[model samples]
Target chain A: MTDRKKTTIVLLSGDYDKVMAAYIIANGAAAYDHEVTIFHTFWGLNALRKDENIQVEKGFLEKMFAKMMPRGVDKMGISKMNFAGIGPKLIKSVMKKHNALPLPQLIEMAQEQDVKLIACTMTMDLLGLQKEELLDNIEYAGVAAYLAEAEDGNVNLFI
Target chain B: MTDRKKTTIVLLSGDYDKVMAAYIIANGAAAYDHEVTIFHTFWGLNALRKDENIQVEKGFLEKMFAKMMPRGVDKMGISKMNFAGIGPKLIKSVMKKHNALPLPQLIEMAQEQDVKLIACTMTMDLLGLQKEELLDNIEYAGVAAYLAEAEDGNVNLFI
Candidate 1:
């Protein structure tokens, strides 16, 4: 392994605010020259999903889940003060007013910075999300791979 | 300062399930001889509240927050399948059937294992929680103190 400091994040929440926080920290760590990985698991995988619908075969539960869950970061709700989904819109408007980058832009910045974005394969299976539905170029991994990186990490966080 | 591995968890969600997961990880790390810390912040501060109400002065907002938040771990709602307050009770019943320890006992186990439990001073202030309203023997700290522990932590988590 290289001697560079490592930062690994396990993004477990689907909330827009939580995902933004994870990406912000990941981007910050990357800017600081730390090797960073964001292992997206469970609902966190929603952030990696492509916005456009992809016609992929799925089981009944999977299809139901796919229909219920948000397609991408832009559709996600905040953890608190969601107020029947208006909270995210309000926050986005506030963000624009303050010139802060939105979640999608933050994610793009992470990719531009070469931050490793990994979708947990096990959860993808459980959630019935296929690779075709996720953003391109991101990695697919399991908890073992996550532990391998986090065990040696200087900053390991589960967001 | 010691050679022991470190595991630091920032408990940001007050949900019963989330708090249980955080405590489980902390207890597990402590069992493995890792120096462990659980920094309870934001809604997480609710987990440290005493079951009985205390006579503490508070502003209108703080009082409103206190009234809105759960009294302690037992009163906290589950992150999912809450069903308007049935989830925690259901989970507790299931835990009993499975012989899994409940959150309060899990917290006790962590204390018994010498795992440090810290209440985030900043969030406590923002949430209007008082020292008298929390459990005895827990430390109060801020983000800087959390970072000091987590910077060198082998397994750092924000739950």
Candidate 2:
């Protein structure tokens, strides 16, 4: 292993605000020259989904989950004060007013900064998400990979 | 400074399942002889609350927060499938059937193992949670203290 510090994050929540926080920290760590990795698992996988529907074969439960979950960051709701979808809109407007980047842009910034983003293959199977459903240029791995990175990480987080 | 590996967890979600996961990991790390600290913040503070109500003076918003949030681990809902509070009960029953310890008991075990439990004072102020409202023997700190612990932590997680 190199001498550079490593920061590993396990993104487990599907909420917009939580995902944004994860990306912000990842970008900050990358800017500091840390080797950063974000492992998306469970509901967090929703954040990496492509905005458009992907016509892929799936079982009934898988189809139901795909239909129930949000497609991408823009469609996600805030963890708190999500008053029937109004909270996300309100926060986006507030973010614009304050000249802050939205969640999608923050995610793009993480990619631009070369933060290694991985989708948990186990959860993808459980949730019925195929590789075609997720964004391009992201890797797929299981928990063992996450543990390998986290064990040596200077900053490891499950967000 | 010691040779023992350190695990620092930022408990940010009040969901019963999430809190249980944090405590489970903390307890496991402590059992493995790692120094563990759980920094409770935001909704996570609710996990440290005493089950009984404590009469304390508070502003309107704080009072409203106290009234709305769950009093303790037992009262907290699961992050997913919380069908109007039935989820907690169902999980509790399942835990009992499997002979697994409940959240409160898991917390007790953590304390028994000497895991450092810290309540975020800033969040306490924002949520209007006084010391009297929380459990005894736990320390109160802010983000700076959390950062100090986390920066040196071998396994730092924000759960």
Candidate 3:
């Protein structure tokens, strides 16, 4: 018998806060007995890999960039309008101070929660990303792959 | 003199887990005498409106979707992710249990904290939205407008 609860989320942005939030949510969902999966595409792909050195920038132009763009994900240059501002920074600091898990730890938590992690084939190919670039145990998938998972009455969301 | 000890967050993602996490962190920031602000745009706009009718569907599919999505703005479609499983429904539930604020109320709290609320003009235009479409008392701006506010270096973020 198939499990009745499932959800699919495609994470396209690779900003620290966005990814971290997803990780936290996936763990919370798991506590509720929901199966989870994450599809990383475009800028979000940067986070799936283990060796990426991206840091949440805290500079003048970076600050300005955050205010106009939609914050972190928008700043990853994903062909969307930028909405950068101070609201997010405050939250990040507090989370960090309260000992929020780092990105790697968040991914680990998601995995522990049975959250499936997928890398978008199109974005990976365009970006020239190799399987070695992403962390181990991650599946490479296409739009069809994601759609198939979403087809099982599981909700699909584009984050 | 420029006021000090204010921490602001510019929330761009409407993901339920992320939004609620930001608020929990905001409450933490407030403890440190930091002011918090959450700017809503695009998908995040859904989390801000007070009169949104979040219709929950019945059956397995609806249950799955609900499990993946957050109930209100704090549990928003905030991030640009498509969580593959256990995403929406779980987020929605926890937000309700935690008594988290919707995007509108979160905005109001920021105002109460003297935090500025700015909506992105570019996102509004791209999404074919009007100022009237947003909650009242929101200051509207293009990228340039948000940049002007971000210029002040009180700490910023993109979530």
Candidate 4:
């Protein structure tokens, strides 16, 4: 295995389905022995939020931003046909029926598989999300960090 | 050139940003000499619509469906902060200043690079979009067709 391949995924959407797809791809790539890195930016940062409120010192706008967006994968809405937020519930039910892991579980699985998770520092600053607001064990980086990794990656995707 | 790889993308979002990412990846993959196939399903089918009205014989539902959705890539709204459809235009100006191609032009580049475009028949049926409502030179296919192609693909994405 001298020639280990790399997969870099830029998760730019915070929608449940899109985030799920990112983890699915990352997990699959990891399963095949490829190093996978997911860069979470902008709306994608929603997937990394902690479900429980972690009182972190922030400005009023940051507090409002965190309050308004979904806390975590479980709370994110579908990209379309959200239908007053029932759409995510419906999709979860379907996933359960199919014995597929929900978004939260998928993220955990990717973590267990040693997939590198990088949260975008620029987005966090813009959205006013503090480190305490996000889940643990994730790296914080800028676009240059992602581009550096993607430069040598055999597979790179922006979603 | 012997072990040429393949990339398959399942485009399921019609949002301007998402659709742009899809075409960008498709074009990048094609430029690398990989055989790329994009399966446009559900909302993704919206991206393939012709900007001009196509005279196609269809049922009332199909006519209504066509009328409701954005005509083509040029008209798609951003997934968030659309602000009554101004977000896409703002993004377009940014793209132009960056010397980046607009979504429509990106789609055209992918096509010229010989990327395979597949419209999901099941989605078309469900959405009541007739074949005539879409652009020309695209293959209409069901899930099985996509699966067959993806089976041998090295990179598979759902966006």
Each prediction's Cα lDDT score? 0.87, 0.87, 0.55, 0.83
State the displacement of the C-alpha of residue A147, model 2, in Å, after optimal TM-score superposition.
11
TM-score of 2: 0.64
lDDT by residue (A1-159, candidate 4, tens digit) is 248899999898888888998899999999999989999976899999999988788765456556667889888888889998899999999999999999888899998999999998756775678898888999999766665566557787878
DockQ, every prediction: 0.23, 0.23, 0.03, 0.07
- Superposed model 1: Cα runs more than 4 Å off: A24-33, A48-74, A78-83, A86-114, A118-159, B24-33, B51-67, B79-87, B90-102, B105-114, B120-148, B154-159
Model 2 Cα lDDT, one tens digit per residue, A117-149: 999999999899999999999999999999999
Error of 1 at B151 (Å): 4.7
Cα error, residue A145 of model 1, in Å, equals 7.3
Among all windows of 10 consecutive residues in model 1 chain B, the one with the lowest summed lDDT is: B59-68
Instruction: Judge candidate 2 against the unseen true structure and give its global Cα lDDT, from 0 to 1.
Output: 0.87
lDDT of 3 by residue, B5-76 (tens): 544454656665566665556666665676545555544554544444434334442233233333345334
Please give fnat for model 3. Answer: 0.00
2 or 4, which is superior by TM-score?
A: 4
In terms of lDDT, the poorest run of 10 residues in model 2 chain A is A90-99
Q: Mind listing the fnat for each candidate?
A: 0.41, 0.41, 0.00, 0.03
A48-91: candidate 1 lDDT, tens digit per residue: 99999999999999999999999999899978657788667766
How do all models score by TM-score? 0.64, 0.64, 0.43, 0.64
Give model 1's docking category. Answer: acceptable
The collision pairs in model 2 are none
Docking quality class, candidate 3: incorrect
